[model samples]
Target: MLTNNIIFYSDESSIKISVNKDLFNKMYQYCDKSYPNETGGILIGTYLDKQTAEIVAVIGPSEDSKTWKTRFNRGAKGINKLLKEYWEQGIYYLGEWHFHPNGSPYPSNIDTDTLTSISNNSKYSCPEPILIIISGSHNCYNQKSYLYSSTGQKFEMNC
Candidate 1:
């Protein structure tokens, strides 16, 4: 079933995230295909307000990336082109999504580091970036989403 916009809050920040049933199904399928290895991609969506974002699409991993049972390195290949195309269509780069094979859907140290880098990097342009972690076996999957603000605060959102 499709989820309505869900609001999650931290002491310093809050955000709203939503995923349609179709998009969820597609992400699940992609995660399943990468079973026993980690996979990830960028999240495309629009901001509803200063603190809220609506996730409309989840792009799959780049073909140049490396995936292993414990790690996933998202390569920078064709992403700029895709981002340009999406920007032309009025969709902005909201955040990222990744799967953790046989693990919990919580952010790891590396995940937090990556999010921090994204928030601090001038190239990203987004002051607050979302991170969605999908974890489970091939038969089932779960998600844990977080929002990281430029101030270095991270909030775990309900999914």
Candidate 2:
């Protein structure tokens, strides 16, 4: 069940965001190679069956800014484009994703702030957007994925 603007799906929960394996790899590379410090992107998807949110795509910034670590957000202009696309179809911003160098994939204080800002900034916000953290770049397939709640209040899954 969803409460306080947070939802999850497991082939059982109401909201389910379908993840694309190919796109997941891209996000991983963004952090593991191009930007070892931090990598971020947007989650694109359609609202499903009036219950779950299924992630359909990913969009990363061609530009970025360093914030103690690197940060990526869709530019305002790009977001406008995305909004128009969403309206045309019926989908909207699903959530946000990023990388964690060595932290436990847990929500750091800063992470909580970011999530809060996202939730409060828009009328189209989900109870919580899917927050993904890729960790354990210690080697290769050993990478772990952590899913944080929309509010960055807790881990929805292990990463």
Candidate 3:
């Protein structure tokens, strides 16, 4: 588990991501609540610069979302409303986060495809999106962060 805020940089140094300890704990709690079933939510934060983002908040799984042992289909329920509220606080939608339960933090093919779709979707209004995948149990957890571009490029963020 993460005890402090961490910073990650892409291999190309094109982007930087910062995740705080509180947010990490919150994601852990959400993952714990779902247990064997996969669960996920949206990430909300602001850009510190053209290439840097600091994750400040996370919205957990929606009521309409579908969660299976190996797959999670995030629903759109209440997300627009939540995004509007967060926008008032200057917290824009940064990307998404999910738990893999006993699996690796690395993203699967579906994840990559979904992220690419999100990047191209104007409804999201984010040309590039970030993804955070958390895996493992309460005692020992792992996390991987990725950035996806509208051009179908994926960048893995490194510590």
Q: Pick the candidate with the highest TM-score.
A: 3
Greater-TM-score candidate between 1 and 2: 1
Error of 2 at 89 (Å): 2.2
TM-score of 3: 0.94
**lDDT digits (tens) for residues 1-159 of candidate 2:** 122222344432334555556666777677666344666677778866775566666666535434224443434446667767776887678767777665455555666677666766666465565666665463442233223444544445421
**Among all candidates shown, the one with the greatest lDDT:** 3
What is the lDDT of every predicted structure here?
Answer: 0.81, 0.57, 0.90
Query: Taking the tens digit of each residue's C-alpha lDDT, what string does model 3 give over 2-97?
Result: 357788898765789889988888999999899889999999998988888988898899999999988999999999999999889889998999
Q: Which portions of model 2 miss their true places by more than 4 Å? A: 1-14, 62-64, 67-77, 138-155
Better of 1 and 2 by lDDT: 1
User: Residue 136: error of model 3 in Å?
Assistant: 0.9
Provide the lDDT at 28 for model 2. 68
- lDDT by residue for model 1 (26-127), tens: 778888899889999888888767766777888999899899999999987999898889888888888888999889998988988888888888776767
- The C-alpha TM-scores of every prediction are 0.89, 0.69, 0.94
Please give the range of 10 consecutive residues that has the lowest summed lDDT in model 3.
1-10
